[model samples]
Target: MAKSKDISVVIPLYNEEESITELCKWISRVMESHGFHYEIVIVDDGSTDNSWEIINNISSENGSVKAVKFKRNYGKSAALNTAFRCSEGDVVITMDADLQDSPDEIPELFKMIKEDGYELVSGWKKKRYDPLSKTIPSKFFNYITRKITGIKLHDFNCGLKAYTSELVKSIEVYGEMHRYIPAIAKWNGFNRIGERVVQHSARKYGQTKFGLERYIYGFLDLLSITFVSKFKKRPMHFFGTMGTLSFIFGFIVATYLIGEKVYINLFLNERARGVVEQPLFFLALTALIIGVQLFLAGFLAEMISINSNKKGDYLIEKKIGL
Candidate 1:
């Protein structure tokens, strides 16, 4: 077991070689000024630049700076997941390496977690430095997120956030689910989430690594988390409901068509077309087949859910006890 620290600043960086040294220095000043016993854990997400080298040098220069390098670009979620597993801080803080997320908020965030009794605290970039291109889409995304998760944080994707070590350890962040950390925490029974109006600065170095596709992925991740959180232990609840409805609808349509044909032939005493000759017959047959397939899918999903372990198993290339 590692010695517990007051705070562990976990940064997930990609090609952020230029700003890291300055970021670390700023963080060190904040931590030292606050009289905090902190460790800076930087996860280098397979940067092709000198980011890894810079990380090694920074760790050597500052003994409190620990490092982890991924073998490839596994993404921000993977980086956070790996660092959370190894953090030794009572309250863990996650921030971006782009210099947009200020280290000055660390003390207040720490206080919210320790003194204010919040399980997780998310930073809200109320006055964002980002342009309308990013901000507009972000607002739309945040609105949808707030409506769905019922956590009214203005910015769900803000990197500047704090969590109790227990909260981070209990939840898993994979894919683009990092944006929904609070939702994930809530799903794991940590509902005491707080939001702080943090200062968001303009990027000092490196262009935004993400593109418009991020919102698309974010929405997909939201749907995934919603389904998984509700039905992970019982996938049959979702798949089975859809399957049953489809099967019942198809059966009703088939029966109605068959009964109409029988009535025309027997009661009306008129010749009726054969069931197979009508297009309705094929449509009903297709629906029945689809319904059966959906039911089988639900059955298979249930079987898999019984044995599934959904936690991430990312490959760590290097670690300082991380």
Candidate 2:
């Protein structure tokens, strides 16, 4: 096993050849000035450029610099997730390789995690240099995320963040869920999430990899995480409730129509429209069928949830003398 360090700065990069060297040097300077026993873990996400070569060169020169190069480009989430598993640090800090996230924020973030008892500390870029086209949607995205996840962080997608080693290991980040790490931490019971206003520099090299479509995907992922967190253990709660309501509504409407027809035919002695002929009869039938289908779906989900193998599904747990 590799020796653990006081801090591990994990950077995930793709096609960032121009900025990788400078970023590593800046991080080393910060760690040295702060007297931190630190290791820099840089993951090259299958960059076709010279980023992986630069990483290899840096790691060769600096023993504290550990690097990984993927066979092909996985998204940022995969890069970060893999690095989290490989990191051996008491406190883990993640920053973008684009140099937009400043290395100066490391010390304070480290303090927040170590001294302030924060399980995770996310950076907030209070002032940004990006164009309105990007910044506007980002603001809206953060606002909606705040409302849904209730994490209270102004910037959830900020790559410059710090975490306790335990917090990072306890959570699993996948899909486009990188933006919701704070929320994921909270769901995993790491509720002591803090935020610091950090400097966001203009990109010194390469263009932004993400586009406007990310916001749409982000919103969908937010909803997905919320649903999974709330209902993963008891999916029947959601589906069953909706199904029951729909079934009751349909039953009530059908009964009322039948009763009205019977009254008109027997008591009033007048011809009444056939129940099958009324448009509401078909509406009620459709609702009933949909309700049954949803209820059955919930039943299957519950069965799968009960029978699925749950052992070894969780992250590492501390034991005294196991």
Candidate 3:
């Protein structure tokens, strides 16, 4: 194991061969000028381009640079999670490899965790250089995320952030949950989260690896995190509550239909439509079945949770040790 350093820069990149070398050099310059002992841990998320080759060359020339290349593309969250495991630094700083995330913010981010008593410090790209197509959706989603997660961060998906080793190691970032790191940290009891307005640069090299589909996945992941954070240990609370309400509503509807049928048959000459002939009866039956299934689903999920591994798994094709 490498000795614990003052800072660990974990950059997760995919097909960013064009920018890897320059980004590393920039980080080295910033950290060296600040007189901080730092290690740059670059994680290549199975880039098909020459990214791994560039990373290897950079690592060979610079002892401070270490890298892990994935066996396949596992997404940014998986890359970060794997790097966090391998990082041996007091303050773990994560940034993008595309050079858009400035390395100059490292000093303050380190101070926020090491000196200011914050568990996690997220970067806010106050003035993004993205096109309207990206910025508009990002702003709307950030608004919704702030309201839902209560983290008060302007940019939850900003790749530049800092964390105490304890905070990063305590939380798991997987399944596109990298966008909700602050929220995840808060849920795990690291509530002293701070934000810094960092410099965001325009893409000077490759195109963005992400599409609008990421935002769609991000919204779903936020809902998943909200549910898991609250009911991870006791899923019965959520599923059972919803199931019980649905079952009650359906039972009430069924009882009403049956009672009306009996009343009409007893008091009027006209025959009441059979309860089975009514659409309400079928709808009520479907609701009852759905409620039962949901309750069963909760039970099944609880069982899997008990036996499933909470820590994520990933395949590393190669490692360049420091």
Candidate 4:
């Protein structure tokens, strides 16, 4: 087993050749000044530039600097998740490699995790240096996330965040779900999340890797994570409820139409329009079909959830006896 350190700074980079060396030096300086036994785990997410080469050179020189290079770009979340598994620090701090996230915030974040007892501490970039195009959407995204997750953090997507070793190890970050790490942590029972106003610097190296499309995907990911976290084991709760309501609604509509036709024809002794002629009949038929499909879908999901192997889905905190 690898030796544990006081702190581990995990950075996920893609094509950040210019800033890797300087960022490592800055982190080293801060760690040394603070008397922290720290390791820097930098994951190169399949960068096409010299980023991986620079990382390799840095790791060769600094024994504390660990590096991982992907053959192809897997994305920031994959990089972070991989590093999280390999990190052996009591406190794990994550920051962007674009130099936008300041290394100066590391000490206070570390203190928040160690002394203040926060399971996860996310950085809030109150005054950002990005253009309105990016900042505006980011603000809106964070606002919606805050409302949904109820975490009260202003910046949920900020890369400069800190987590306890246990918190990092317990939660899984995948897809574009890295933006909702706080929400994930909360769902995992790490509710003591903290936020600190951190220094956000303008990019010192390459251009922004992400575009506006990220916000669109980010919104979809938020809904996804929320649903999966709440109902991963019991998907029937969502699908079954919707299916039941839809089926009942269709049944009621069809019943009303049929009853009206029967009453008009039999009681008034007058010819009535056939229930099949009304557009409502088709609507009801469509709804009924959809409802049955949804219900069967839910049933299948339940069966899969029951039969699926969940060997490593849970982490045991303690054991009393065999």
Candidate 5:
């Protein structure tokens, strides 16, 4: 007899053939107890090892198991993106390929999304088994994300996330932004994001591919998201604001110079130097030039905001399809 599938688990795999089979067995044991139809989608992200072969064998044994292979390593984002397209379950769960993220927590994540009305539910590793090297940078990253994104979750990048199809399709998880899915989902107007403390086992296979540099990238991405959120439509609002402030500060400096000359002429009873001779004149001139450049920048940004529909286009006119 064949089992009907209701829940789809999408795992992005890269050089983890040793762990895939064990992970699948665990998933089968835990998920079948819930008495719901489920399918496992393993996205092979260009693994140089025999991961694709392993996934193919599993898919043949169990109709519920599916595999998607990439030609080369396009990263976790591309893997997830491809897996999302292949999913067919009512609930879609995303977890790491390594055996660290526990399959036992899948039921709870499923319950949260299906019953609790949460559009997205991410797992929180309150007590991670990772070393201090990984954990320290992770803490800083999560801290900044909480402050800027305001989701207040302990772990935003915990690969064990459950999502409905709506939230999945609304947000794009490219360029290391997969680590900030909660932030992206929030920016897209999905605020019903909930988090649960899930079990985090030590990695039994494969080394952590990420490094501390991801924290730096994450902080920069936070700034990018914040800017895009506040000024996506009115980019001039940001640039124009800096331009106006610079111009005003420059004007104030020039005004001070005028006042100094006025005092010398009136009180000291001496002829004052012309505005052109004062050193303040050069300062004001520099300020004015900088201000003009910023203003022009804002103007150009406004025009770009109007036409930045294609993000990959380097030359603005190239996107015009000419």
Candidate 6:
């Protein structure tokens, strides 16, 4: 690792051909002005548009630009993971190809990540130009992410973010969780996180690729991150806790049912009845079953973790052909 490093800009494109040429030129100007060594990695995520031709032209003109064209669209996660695997700079920055994220904000983000010693710095669009439909759901999503991950980032879904080489290389972004990079970094012991109020422009060249269903998936991914981060190596801590709480609640419910049965049998002189046919019994049975299953899941996770440790499964083998 170098003391002062250049920035690697990674942009993931999906049918975003119109923005690629302009974005590459803009990034080149920034790189030249800042006097930092940089590479523009444009990952074409199986774009049905002429995205590859545009990226090739840009990468050819400027020696700084490199691209990986996916045979088919594998989503943003695959594109980012592939780009990160091939990036060569000390500071890795990621932005969307839709031109909503301003390239002019790159230098400041790079400065914060490199000079300020922040492991991760994410952009916050204070005044988004999105419609109420997108903005409303985004706010709720960010709130849920903060609550679950305990990372105080306002815009977890912001595409504009910069990460130190160590942090970027160490972490793996899969599923729809690239939006939660800050939280992921926090969970990986990279606690020095920062945020910058970046300039967010309305879509200039293409339509938004965002949808409401992505928020639903993002929320679910946060839950997965929460459990995996807090208890990846100790799954029993999480599952066991849930199991114990469920079992306790079930026990209380069963005890109340027993008391009710005793009173009914003695005071009312009703027929003696077994509890299994009762609804409370079914609830108790369900709880007990779920509890035991969760406990076993934790135990299984523990075994898998131990086996993984022995196997030495790693995410990044090398960076930029290192």
- lDDT, model 5, position 148: 83
What's model 3's overall lDDT? Answer: 0.90
Worst 10 contiguous positions by lDDT, candidate 6 = 312-321
Q: Looking at model 1, report the run of 10 residues with the lowest lDDT sum.
A: 313-322
Query: Per-residue alpha-carbon lDDT of model 5 for 273-298, expressed as tens digits?
Result: 98879887888878877887888888
Better of 2 and 4 by lDDT: 4
Question: Which stretches of candidate 3 lie above 4 Å from their native place?
Answer: 1-3, 263-271
TM-score: the better of candidates 1 and 2: 1
The global C-alpha lDDT for each of the candidates, from Candidate 1 onward, is 0.91, 0.88, 0.90, 0.88, 0.82, 0.82
Mark the regions of model 6 whose C-alpha exceeds 4 Å error after superposition: 1-5, 244-284, 308-322
Model 3, span 236-294: residue lDDT tens: 87788788888888999999999999889888756999999999999999889888987
- Writing each residue's lDDT as its tens digit, candidate 6 over 1-322 gives 7444388999988988888788888888888898878888877877787877777677667877777777676778877877887787889999999888888999999889878989889999999998999999899988888887778989998999998888888888776768877877887889999999999998998677877899878878888877677788888888888988888888888888888889899999997577777887889878988888888888898889888743112233212212
TM-score of each: 0.95, 0.92, 0.93, 0.92, 0.85, 0.84
Ordered by TM-score, highest first, the candidates read: 1, 3, 4, 2, 5, 6
Lowest lDDT 10-mer window, candidate 3? 304-313
After superposition on all CA atoms, how large is the RMSD of candidate 6?
Answer: 4.3
Write the number of the candidate with greater lDDT, choosing between 1 and 4: 1
Off by over 4 Å in 1: 1-3
| Model 2: per-residue Cα lDDT at residue 200 | 95
**Candidate no. 5 TM-score:** 0.85
For residue 151, give model 6's deviation from the true position in Å: 2.1
lDDT digits (tens) for residues 1-322 of candidate 4: 7656999999998888899999999999999999999999887777789877787788778889987777777788888888898788899999999899989999999999999999999999999998999999999999898898888999988999999999999988887788999999999999999999999998887799899999999999999999989988898998998898889889999999999999999999999999999999999988898889889988999999999864322221211110
Query: Candidate 1: lDDT of 121?
Result: 97
Candidate 6 lDDT (Cα, 0 to 1)? 0.82
lDDT of 1 by residue, 1-322 (tens): 7656999999999999999999999999999998999999989888999998888888878999998888899999999998898788999999999999999999999999999999999999999988899999999999999999999899999999999999998988888889999999999999999999999999888799999999999999999999899988887777778777777877888898899889999999998888788887778778777778878888898899888776677666887644
- True-structure RMSD, every candidate: 1.7, 4.7, 2.0, 5.5, 5.7, 4.3
Model 1, CA-based lDDT: 0.91
